[model samples]
Target chain A: MNRKRSVWFLTLFSLVAVVTVFYVSDRPSPFDGIQLFSDDTLDEVGLVETSSTNEESFVSKSNAFEEMRMEVTEKRSQLRDQLTTKVGSNEFTAEQKDEAYNQIEELVKIDSTEAMLELIIKSLGYDDALVRIEESDVFIDVVSNEQSTKKASEIIYQVKREWPEAYNVEVSFDGQ
Target chain B: MIGILVVAEGANDKRIQNSLIKTLSSVLQISPHRIVIEEMELEDK
Candidate 1:
């Protein structure tokens, strides 16, 4: 009985193997029609929709830009009116007036540090003193003969006390 | 008088600036419009 069972199991295994091979070899695979380089179906649909959406976006952005430009222009005109009125009513020292004019000219050039310094020095009446400029910063120091060393020191002290942004004023006393 | 510049960021900044100007005008005998105020928005980079 054991020998008969073993012969039946062998016959069943060989039959199953033969059937699987026949099934595999008989028909084309489901992936046979696919091509790696073919146009993607979903991307083509999205590309058409995206192009139309971009047109609308561009138009909306352009309108926004125009609105901003017009608003800025109106604001500028209003500011100019205010400035003119203020200038007419305000009273400034002669030095302040000169500095104001120089500042306007300097501001037009985008950078007027040198012109600003010149105006500052002249306004403070320190043009004759030695001026040192370093990296957008200015230092004022008095240079004089031995007899005037004390006077120079006093002037430096006075300047430091009076100016708002004065941090670099020095006076040499008798070369010491 | 020395120039005073105030820079602020966005609408909240404008509200704070307006409140400050109102208070200063009421207390310091200064005109509200005379203060130099500028507005700037924060940048990502």
Candidate 2:
């Protein structure tokens, strides 16, 4: 009985193996139907540039205002970090750390002052603006529909109102 | 000012923008021209 069963199993196994071999041996690749190099798909996809008429767009676009702001922030932050490192390092004396702390505080105050001035300028009716304070000079450039003397006067008035100091203020506008 | 800041986002338009800008200017004590509703991105809202 065992010998007869073994013979049947061998016959069935051989038959299944022969069928699978014939089924896949000469068949063209089934993936041939898929279009892997279609140009139409690429043509349908394109870049979408951000186009907005707000301060957000002014800051987001690859423009001078955003670049200037980012550069200022980067440089200030790097300076702040160096001061922080000096304050934290064990090699520094208490007096040195105190000086570093004072420098960091000054940096913070400068950053806050610049931000406040910028916000005030933006609130004063310009589309967007950047304010930079260097020692005794306060530099500002704004965007608006008209860059008249009257508009510049209004901006200077507002800037001085918020920041009352003897700093030499310079105002410029771009009617873009 | 933004329309979405006052009313529903989908209902924002030119009229709504003008209205919202005035409202924002008055509330924030800022000039209307300083606030551009059209240039404000929805995601930034």
Candidate 3:
């Protein structure tokens, strides 16, 4: 009788444990809720900030694209400065200086091209467009608030016409 | 070769999707399969 009782107790315990595991796994996590709430709050804050500005708000319409272009320009300037320093340094070999110069030149070219492409995209009615050139590939991110594939194709056609030697040009839209 | 990804609020709209694909194909001279469209909620600032 004792053995039978022990068996029944073990069965009940196992069942409870399995049920607990399933229940825990099925329940939504509190962290997920917190994250979602925080994201919503941030979005609200952004909206408020944009709305508060009357005059500057017009420029802020393409804030993302402007920020991206600024960042690229800053990076290009830094790279150029570094290349100049390296080339003038007597510690580095001629070959090293040449390589550094070549790399920096290539980077500057890409940066300039990206900036130009972004300007073209903006002129094509995608004011919030970003262009990034990596190696031979070009990536375009256009705000899709009023963007269409037709506008995207127009940008692509312009890129091809201007830079036919580019390896791959990829365009993506960023909604946020 | 250009790969296009369009993120729009109404990405599920059939008209937008069809027009985007058709435009990309004609302009890029590539198959419609090459252009990818994704939908996301974007907050306008």
Best by lDDT: 3
Clashing pairs in 1: none
Residue-level lDDT tens digits of model 1 in A85-168: 444556766666566555444333322332353344445443223343333334544222243655656555555544435566
In candidate 1 the C-alpha lDDT for residue B14 amounts to: 36
Lowest lDDT sum, 10 consecutive residues, model 3 chain A, at: A52-61
Specify the highest-TM-score model's number: 2
- For each prediction in turn, the share of the native Cα contacts (below 8 Å between chains A and B) that it retains comes to 0.00, 0.00, 0.00
What tens digits encode model 3's per-residue C-alpha lDDT throughout A109-160? 7767776877787787654667777766778887655556776678789888
Provide chain B TM-scores across all predictions. 0.51, 0.56, 0.68
Using alpha carbons, what is the TM-score of model 1? 0.24
- lDDT by candidate, in order shown: 0.48, 0.70, 0.70
Could you give the CAPRI-style class of model 3? Answer: incorrect
Q: What fraction of the reference structure's interface contacts does model 2 contain?
A: 0.00
Residue A124 in model 2: lDDT: 79
Model 2 lDDT tens row, A11-30: 99999999999887988766
Model 3 segments beyond 4 Å from truth?
A: A1-61, B1-45
Could you tell me the lDDT of residue A31 within candidate 1?
71
| Candidate 2 clash pair list | A53-B39, A54-B39
Quote the TM-score that chain A achieves in each candidate.
0.27, 0.59, 0.56
- List the lowest-lDDT window of 10 residues for candidate 1 chain A: A106-115
